[model samples]
Target: MIGLVLAAGAGRRLRPYTDTLPKALVPIDAETTVLDLTLANYAEVGITEVAIVVGYAAETVASRVKGFEERYGVHLELVHNDKAETWNNAYSLWCARDLLTNGVMLANGDTVHPASVQHTLLDARGDGRQIVLALDTVKKLADEEMKVIWSESAGIERITKLMDPASATGEYIGVTLIEPTAAADLTDALRVTWERDPHLYYEDGYQVLVDKGFRIDVAPIGTVDWVEIDNHDDLDRAREIVCPS
Candidate 1:
């Protein structure tokens, strides 16, 4: 399976560090940045063909990726998202539609989790579902993170609630395994939504799919070591999880 890393965001939440460097390139541990750590994680699972969708500070990201490829002997494909500023992550996914046709492992660039990924892939492979989104049961659900409510028996995941920390049933772990057929449908839905409502976030597309009666299975990565680095505090927490010095 091919890997798609959505690294196109400007990371306004992580500014002024991101003012000069992209969020993906921000140093996390002693030497590895978020992007490098993520790539290394993928490499560990034998996912060598990687496509990173880049935006704000795309050149710097590209340069860093090149260095990583040379050092790790991995193939990294860099795709640019020109409309990254105006569009949401759906646009970044759309940019790599061609590569994601069969079955692609989609990951958020800022997420650092290597262990859960293998379990996620196994879950996706065992079930013949169209989309499989990784989820975790966190003690404190933050308001900024996406929340999911799913049917345990049917494995039907629905974004029934948005950024409601109190109403959240579970936390989305920023990793998804998607079938090409469902991804194509999602792409079409995303395009329609963008044309109708340009300000909609990517989770809106998940809502659309759920509303359309599509079965999106939830692969629970229960209590796994995972981190989504959105702000400075999150980065610190991730460092503790990944480096632990």
Candidate 2:
């Protein structure tokens, strides 16, 4: 298995920070960037080979790819997502389908969280289960959050933002483990999602698999500190929790 990061979208809401650089390159601290921390986490988990899907301000990430690889002691693969500016992550992820066949520790570039989130997903892997998502059952869900649905019989039946916040089991923390067993199905699902609607998230691919009788399990990272940096407030929250007091 290897590390895979989807850092393609133009986070327009972030303004100046994303004006020149992609959101992944946005600094979380004086020195570390969102991509930096992601690579560090992958390295910590012993994943030495990492693939990053880049678009939007692709040059910025491309220029620094070598440096990031050296800094994290990991081999890097840069996948290009041409439709990043106009399409949602479903297409961005589909663009990586050819390269990520050996299973993947998939992460969204815009999210910031401790390495434990990755650890949880990796550790939660089971012999028969092919997909395991890092879920935050403790976090209070808002309408914008990608919520999960699970029951005693169905582990994770669905994952989407359209679900009512009051009934959601947890928030899908934008981190997932795709074992080799599920790669082909996930690729097909992603392709179908992009073909159907370019504005759909890769999470829609997960739901596709779930609806097809694929048992997507959840690893509840209880009370974990994490943030998805979508807007200015999220950036502040990331700094507060990701940086030491």
Candidate 3:
């Protein structure tokens, strides 16, 4: 299967650091950055076809990954999203819809996780489920993290996007495995949401799919080493969890 990395965001929360370079290219530990760690994990899972959607400072992000294209035997396809400044991640995923067909692993560029986690998720996809959203029970979910209220009886029957801090139940660890049919449904829903709210998040589209009686399997990652770097503090936390200074 192929891997799609959504790296088109401007990372406004990252401030001065992202002002000069894309968050994917920001150095973490040793010499690896967010994108480097993510690509390496994908390669380890035997996903050699990688598509990266780039936006702000695309050239620099592309340059950072050039070496890995040959080194890891991954065929890297870079798709540019010119409207990244105005659009959200839902748009970035839509941009790579063609590649996402035939089932693919989708991830955010700034998330760092173990290669084994990806393998585990893929192993769970044999039943032809429409969508599988990776989730983890976080001890303390911040207000900004995406949270979901899933039902074990019906799988991920419903997902609440950008859940309020006070109402959050569990955290959605930004990795998803989706079937082509589900991807198409999500893409269509995204179009509708975008027409009404240009800055709509990808989760908003997923919620629509849930409302349509589409079953999304919730795969709980459970107490794993994963990090989503959005700010300077997160960078430090990532270093500690992923590589450690």
Candidate 4:
């Protein structure tokens, strides 16, 4: 399976940092970035070919493609998301549907996480689950989180940000393992989700899949220090967890 990254979001809340660069390019340390770490993590797990969906500030990421490839020793394929600035991630993800023909481990470009999270998903894929989502059962859920409600027998019953935090089982940590068998269905689901509402998140597509009787399973990442950089505060938290003082 190849690695996939959805880096099309504008991340307007990140302001100055994202003014010129995409959120994936935000510095995690002097020499590394959120995208850098994600590529490195994928490389570590033997995924050499990675496809990145780029949209807002796409030129910035484009210029760094060769540098990133040489640094990570991985081949990079850039997928253009024309609607990134106006539409949400559902369309951004669907734009890369052709590349998703093979199995893919998708990561959100805005998320800063450890390699262990990737390892967890890879290990869990052996169980034959069509879609394996990395869940953080340890994190305290809030309305902002992409919450999930699941059971061992039923798998994921629901996944959405609008769900009641008190009733959620955990937060999806922006990593998912999609088996090749489920790719076509997932792509169609995402297309439907975005067509229904251009502002819907890709997670909403996952909800559509669940509603259609997809066998989706969640793999808890155990206890890991990770952050989805949505705003300045999240950026600070990511730097603390990834770079420290």
Give the poorly placed runs of model 3, Cα more than 4 Å off: 161-169
Each candidate structure's TM-score, on Cα atoms with residue i matched to residue i, is: 0.91, 0.97, 0.92, 0.98
For model 2, the stretches where C-alpha displacement exceeds 4 angstroms are none
Candidate 4 lDDT, 39-84, residue by residue in tens? 9999999999999999999999999999999999999999999999
Which of the two, 1 or 2, has more lDDT?
2
- lDDT: the better of candidates 1 and 3: 3
TM-score quality measure for candidate 1 = 0.91
lDDT of 1 by residue, 1-245 (tens): 87788888888888887886767888886688877777776777777888999988898887776689976567889988898777777777777878868577888888988755655665556556888888777657866677887786756555744556776668878888887778678887777767767667666777787778777887777677777888989988888887776
Q: Which regions in candidate 4 have their CA more than 4 angstroms from the true location? A: none
The lDDT, on a scale of 0 to 1, for candidate 1 is 0.77
lDDT per model vs. reference: 0.77, 0.89, 0.79, 0.92
Choose 1 or 3, whichever is better by TM-score: 3
Tens digits of lDDT, candidate 3, 45-144: 9888989999988988777666978777788989988888888887777778777676788889888888766876887886768788888766577667
TM-score of 4: 0.98
Candidate 2 or 1, higher TM-score: 2
